[model samples]
Target: MTDPTPLTSLSSALADVVARAAPSVVSVHSHRARSTGFVWKSGLIITADEALADEGEVRIGLPDGSTVAATVAGRDHTTDIALLRADTSIAPVRLTRTVPALGALSVVVATTRDAPSAALGMVSVSGQGWRSLRGGEIDARIELDVRLRSSQEGGLALEASGEAFGMAVLGPRRVLVIPTATIERVAAQLETRGRIARGYLGLGLQPLRLDDGIGAMVMNVDKAGPAAAAGIRQGDVIVAVNDQKLSGVRALLRTLGPASVGRVVDVAVRRGGEPTSFRVTIGERPEA
Candidate 1:
């Protein structure tokens, strides 16, 4: 027999990797959503929170054409990770802490409603830790140069060596891989408490450009919230927090991440054009 060409070798290697990882990848079904999920532990599966239906009967379609009922153990929308509790014996994927290098080849082993599926792509962008738009702290920024369907949003992003690295989720304009570090952190907390604790100021803010700098004007204040107790009122234009000048509305919101809970900070505001400062204690955001 003639030796396989380089192209044939590459093709066979990719197929082998997909075959090795496809068993742990399952299709998640809900009343209004169908997404991919992977066995994170013996009885827990992790999937994309954005694709999971808020209220529905959830089931996982296994590799052997079997389906099992699952319940929402926890879900964090900020990081877009959801944990499901199911009675499944599917082997959990052995994931690596390796961050995908930029331009490196990768594979997403996922599942459709019927069977296992695969998407071949490359690591388009890789960078250091960054925060999401919803103020979630992601350990690394890994974007994939591949087209993924809505049903395949929560697939397993893997290395060419068949080593699973992270869970792939849909991003605004690109496919994002939620690295192992983030999944380990958020999923642990969710499994323990069923929710991630985030800081809250209880003040609705709008961005306003002042003569000196940008300010966030308080549009509404929760009557019994921390800001109200600190004397922050509606129409008060907040100029700074902890002496750091305000950048914009989004910036202010980002500061209220999990680490800010119970922390005290100086909030400077222009009330009736009078410079006033209030020491406010950040509180936990109430569950929706």
Candidate 2:
């Protein structure tokens, strides 16, 4: 028979992985939301935005049974990543850009309420980049076969080699990893600017049918916005942007992502049956 010691050693190694990562794994408490977060930097914590309460005092419970008050540094709902600022000295997690392979043995180091927790599973699906329903840009689509609790939403996903790769959050039917690349990208901007800006045209549009293609009727325009500066009126019907068909309001929004900010696009509109073209510089969407 094959030696059973190998199995025992493997079990001990898995537990060691969790133990090594537990100090940085914190139990997050914000209003009524009880979830997990990991220290991203010396004084910053990253957690799942969907699991964080919108407005409340944020706090994190440390491994040594200590708690510290935190404040919302920034939050991006589109990607379900939120950053918090606190006075903590727990060692920050060393994140890797490595994408796990399918069927790779994985462990999720998280916390339940005020205590640390761990779950073992496999990388069920690993694919290329994907866009979220809210138009957020996710670097990779990595799913796990692990069963995680509601309080373990923002745990760290690690490989058997003890490589901390990404943050695990509960997705629709499975746990998804917010890859290290995406987290590093968004967290840097949030840490510096307090928010990630998206492009905006400042026009409230409704679908309008035209003879040749789809158009959007501008129901409202911000008087102080770029559209207004470009001579676009509320009743103007926008036919195309940069020669692309305006199929729907969502289509228009899709064009106004992060890269669109500061970009100038030719907006073709119809005013009183007269076609008009204007070069308008897209502006950053104002914070709500």
Candidate 3:
């Protein structure tokens, strides 16, 4: 063999990082499908919500080659995350507080079999906190320049130093890193409430162009829903919610967070060229 080379040294270091982080990575099985997850807390595992099958039991295959039963504690489909409570204790991975720099080397680790699988890639994009396309708040926006396999949807993303950036999920056209802050916040809520309670107005809305910008046009109203009871009729343009200007459909959705449910709020609308307002009671979102 050639004398010790820098390439060899780098390979050795990567091996060590994988060895140390593999214990926290797990294979999640739901509805006869397999994905990945990492231990979040003592008995909680976080995975991509979309990867889980809707009709079957959930289980976790640990790194030690044993499997344990798991239950879906809660899921936030807006962010595409799900929390599972494992029957046995687990070693949670160390999450890095700082955002990873752009173009930095990173690895995605998954526990599909007895050993961990890793994919090396660079941080293709990193930016300040933002919201997903669906209106879910994310702490940091990160995208990896790696094509993730179907089995690695919920794997852990780590920096070169073995510090975890977050969990990886496939977005509409790219792979996204679901930052640790989002994970922790959603996990805590799931652990406490077992579900995310979101407020709903029960109106089918479409975006309409306004001279100022954009507004939501009420296309249909549920006769028995909150909006209908508040006299919000079709053909009305919602201008604002609780004093916040409504620019588009997403803005309205963001305003109706979980805390807004079951609370009375003012809705400003324009009907027939005249401005009107209604005091509407926000209702809990119905099950899908």
Candidate 4:
């Protein structure tokens, strides 16, 4: 008969991790919708912004079966993270800065109606850094091989050691783990300013090949946009931004981060077989 010790030990270890992380997990209720959130700090909770409705009041259900009223301290739609402040206190989960290895054991701890529940999975994808489809800069890309319910969107992604790798959110088609570095960075800014500022160029572009290499082909220009004001027109191939060679749409979007707003930068483009440069000022993206 095969030894059962290994399987028994693995089950016990996972139970211990869930026990340690359960106190930090809470059910967040906003405008009749329910989701999960983890205590980021004393009186502070972090949740998925997309799960939150544009309502006035938010409530947090604690492990002790009591609920506390919470206020929306800040939110960043770009990163899909929201910060909530409450009067109650709970032990915050320990966030690990180290990235988890691919195929490593990971757990998703979520709050159910009565108690905290856990789901088992493994790290399926890991990368250094990347941008989201909406142009948000993610410090590290981590994806899990688990299917999560809508209520588990803002739950914790914990390593086998019980250290939090990040917060789990439902992506376009799969589950995405927002790394700890990104959570900390965005949370700090949101806690301070209540919103993240993003730079906008106001030009629709498509990836196209130029004589030198790959470039972004401008498809449409906003008449009142900074790009239009700087003489950027349709059919122009943008090859470089601030002297950095552009390879695709991702590179251009990555370059236009929050800091690029209002900054004047040189854009190199190929027009009629000759390289031309245009000085354009970045603008703020209009709120949706």
Q: What does the lDDT read for residue 20 in candidate 2?
A: 92
List of clashing residue pairs for candidate 1:
none
Candidate number of the best lDDT: 1
Ranking by lDDT: 1, 2, 4, 3
TM-score of 4: 0.80
Residues 197-267 of candidate 4 have per-residue lDDT tens digits of: 78888899999876678899899998988999999999898999889888798778777778889999999
Better of 3 and 4 by TM-score: 3
RMSD of each: 1.8, 1.8, 3.0, 4.1
Per-prediction TM-score to the true structure, in the order listed: 0.93, 0.95, 0.85, 0.80
Whole-model Cα lDDT of every candidate shown, in order: 0.93, 0.92, 0.87, 0.89
Better of 2 and 4 by TM-score: 2
lDDT of 1 at 86: 95
lDDT of 1 by residue, 160-197 (tens): 98998899999988999999999999999889999999
Residue 239 deviation, candidate 3, in Å?
3.3
Instruction: State, as a TM-score between 0 and 1, how close model 3 is to the true structure.
Output: 0.85
Model 2 per-residue lDDT tens digits across residues 247-268: 8878788767778899999999
**Lowest lDDT block of 10, candidate 2:** 249-258
lDDT of 4 at 167: 94
